[model samples]
Target: MSINPTESCLDCGTPLELTIAGQKKKPCPKCGAYRRKREYQ
Candidate 1:
């Protein structure tokens, strides 16, 4: 399959590396860390 283009992270504006994983609603590292921090608060 062709490598698909990645989308931007909604929270952090980082380019989501979805090229390898395909279209998944995964957050970027910074957003993930921020979300985790918020969840524990």
Candidate 2:
């Protein structure tokens, strides 16, 4: 099987890397430090 190409971080907009483990919802690495999305506003 192959991972879907649509997988990505909603915050930083980075392409999410995948493995045999599984897909999980994780904070964006580029914006992981900031918990709030509205912080930039």
Candidate 3:
């Protein structure tokens, strides 16, 4: 099974529901700017 994680945008703090098999990062919906994913170590 795959574990999907929740990530937030660094600039806008928007909640991102990400899939494990999806891209490492995506653009913020609010700002339309690219945002990095928060690492869960």
User: Which candidate should be chosen as best, given TM-score against the real structure?
Assistant: 3
Compare candidates 1 and 3 on TM-score and give the better one: 3
Task: State the lDDT of candidate 3 residue by residue for 5-36, as single tens digits.
Answer: 56777788887766456555557889876764
lDDT of each: 0.46, 0.46, 0.67
Off by over 4 Å in 3: 1-4, 19-25, 39-41
Q: lDDT for model 3, on a 0 to 1 scale?
A: 0.67
lDDT of 2 by residue, 1-41 (tens): 65444445555656544323464545667766323222111
Worst 10 residues of 1 by lDDT: 32-41
Question: Residue 12's C-alpha lDDT in candidate 1?
Answer: 65
**Model 2: ten consecutive residues of lowest lDDT:** 32-41
The model with the greatest lDDT is: 3
Please give each candidate's TM-score. Answer: 0.38, 0.34, 0.50
lDDT of 1 by residue, 1-41 (tens): 56545456556666544434354444567657222112111
